[model samples]
Target: MSNIQKIGNPARQSNNLLFKRRSILKTLSLAALLPVGLGAYPSGIVIAADGVPLPENVMTPDAALKRLLDGNKRYVSGKISVRDFNVNRAILAKGQNPYACILSCADSRVAPELCFDESRGDLFVTRLAGNYASLDILASLEYGTAVLKAPLIMVLGHTDCGAIKAGMKADKENVDFPGHIQTITSELKSAVKEGVKLPGNATDNVAKENVRLNVAKLKESTPILRQLVADKKLMVVGGLYHLDTGKVELLT
Candidate 1:
């Protein structure tokens, strides 16, 4: 990579990046979304940021959830559909209209796009280890749901989360990292505390419980989100991503 390449035409640069990203994404087994030969989505389908079109049914929370669950079923069965990113790139370049929002972990292996078998632009996502409903995270969600009008929001946790493991160890050992790591550890530990009463492995139980905790927090969020929930315009739910099975087990 040269400095000339770094300052190249912005549009060309963006396209180059998108092309490279698609190349990488296509290689993943779970990145499979819709097969290219399916023709087009129904007349009710609309374009999203990722360039994939979402059916009108996905405009509603229940319908959106169903879409994701079905995709996961396809993923778990290893029956993935092929997608042509070259076409979708043109569609997505115009704009994005994602159907759902997900708060998930930062774990490298836990790619939500693959886990749910969603193409790009189909899901608006925010991630961090031990996915908590922090103030900044809520602000982003407010924009995604209120402005972007995504009907469903899912708080996703996963198995063998390093954040969860670290938080658990911190609780048992009272270890402290040098910087902001302690802060994130603290948030995860709180969820661990809540899940301690449940019977099971500490990290695994906390991972699921953390999702439940965030779901409740987001539902009660005021002004924008709460009102949307009240009007049935938005829904907040939770799930656990099983690493071994490549499945998202809905917690709520």
Candidate 2:
């Protein structure tokens, strides 16, 4: 079986059980704690005493992805219900415990949340022009994995990435930048060089290579993440999202 299927299936089953149990317990707990006038009763419904709905807690990466895929299905099928902005906003105000951290491109078309069909606070995402790894990006990823305790770190790339295109065109004489943009292109130079020799379009080859390199970089650069991997506490994966088809394909 594929890694995505392995990670996704068990988590899906467990999350369903967890949600059912939590829902039942929450209803019972509220019913017992509230006054009779408040009308909080255990009828398998989630109505707060303050007349607000409780926020659904999605704590696991697998569950989060399932939710995203479900939302994507809804989006594709034209079945998206209007979001409960007030309820969602209120719940998120307390805090967030996102399940996964995504390192992806700054491409307008590659919004991780929208592509994954996740809501706000569902993912800890970091974007760079080429989804290149830098010290700051590594630190942020460490923060997400170590501090935030996110179970998964996804290195996401896409077809026809503009940054990769730019890297392909870069030469020693013309490699200039206003500020940090140069740094991004500089990092991507090697991937582009390596990609050009590979048998594919520069964009496609670079995109896949970038994901693989980033995943390897994360595993090697951060001791915290390395320990997590050693302990099986976390998973780092590379994926390619097909922009035209809106499909995500895991890279082994």
Give the top-scoring candidate (lDDT).
1
Per-candidate count of clashing residue pairs (backbone under 3 Å): 4, 0
Tens-digit lDDT track of model 2 for 161-225 = 88887776664347576665666677787677677778867678888988888888777655556
| Best model per TM-score | 1
Can you tell me which runs of candidate 2 are displaced by over 4 Å? Answer: 1-82, 171-178
Give the Cα error of residue 25 in candidate 1, in Å. 41
lDDT of 1: 0.75
Residue pairs with colliding backbones in model 1 are 48-97, 49-96, 50-120, 50-121
Give TM-scores for every candidate, taking all chains together and pairing residue i with residue i.
0.77, 0.69
Local distance difference test, candidate 2: 0.67
- Candidate 1 lDDT tens digits, 1-252: 643366565322322432344433532322233333323333444445343354443468898899889988999999876877776676665455688899999899888788778787788999987888775676688767765678999999998889988888788899997777887787777688887779877778988888888898788744567778999989899999899999899899
Question: What TM-score, to 2 decimals, does candidate 1 have?
Answer: 0.77
Q: For model 1, where is the 10-residue window of minimal lDDT?
A: 29-38
* Decoy 2 TM-score against native: 0.69
